[model samples]
Target: MAVPKRKTSKASKRTRRTHQKASSNAVSYDSVLGVYKRSHYISPDGYYKGRKVID
Candidate 1:
């Protein structure tokens, strides 16, 4: 079996894991509906890319 020869340091571990942190959601505001929604996703009122997709 393989094992680590030395103890891992906190600074080194934290530096490596910096990019592993959770990122904020990409939200955008809909001018027509006046609400915030995730980017590239259709609004709750059936509008996408600034056009009505459904009635």
Candidate 2:
């Protein structure tokens, strides 16, 4: 089995993981309902793309 030749340094490890950090979800405002919701998803009031999709 292949193995690493040396222990990874803290700085090197952290640098490699810089792009792996958690990111916030995309949110947008629902003008009709006057609320915020995740982008591309239906709002709590059953609206999608600025139209009602469910009762």
Candidate 3:
């Protein structure tokens, strides 16, 4: 099967770059209910000092 070619726009490129830049700063995880959870205070030095959740 041949895939159709799509043209990339400058707006799309800028949006992609912005998203990449933002996501590069943190780590995210998913809870048991399948909802997305993200951390804002995590350091780029690879250490996770966030709080834990207790049942």
Candidate 4:
């Protein structure tokens, strides 16, 4: 009896790499300013166009 070996593909490898890279740059909820966030809110980073001042 012969055992079959698992096969790997280039596309799968590329996808895995892309997924890893994306996961490495993921944001954490700890930085979220929930109290300041509103409907149609702009980020505190202040880089958005025509962002309304929260003050």
Ranking of models by lDDT: 1, 2, 3, 4
Q: 1-55 in candidate 4: lDDT tens per residue? A: 9774877688887888885654333332323453433344456765223444554
Using all chains and alpha carbons, the TM-scores for the candidates as numbered come to: 0.75, 0.83, 0.26, 0.25
Global CA lDDT computed for model 1: 0.90
Model 4 superposed RMSD (Cα)? 10.1
lDDT, residue 10, model 1 = 100
Residue pair clashes in candidate 1:
none
lDDT of 1 at 34: 85
lDDT of 1 by residue, 1-55 (tens): 9999999999999999989978899999888888888999877789997899988
lDDT of 2: 0.89
TM-score-better candidate, 1 vs 4: 1
Distance from true position, residue 35, model 3, in Å? 42
Clashes of 1: 0
lDDT of 1 at 55: 88
Pick the TM-score winner: 2
Candidate 2 residue-wise lDDT, 1-55, digit = tens: 9999999999999999999979999999888888888899987778898899988
Count clashes in each candidate, considering only residues at least 3 apart in sequence or on different chains: 0, 0, 0, 0
Quality of model 4 by C-alpha lDDT = 0.50
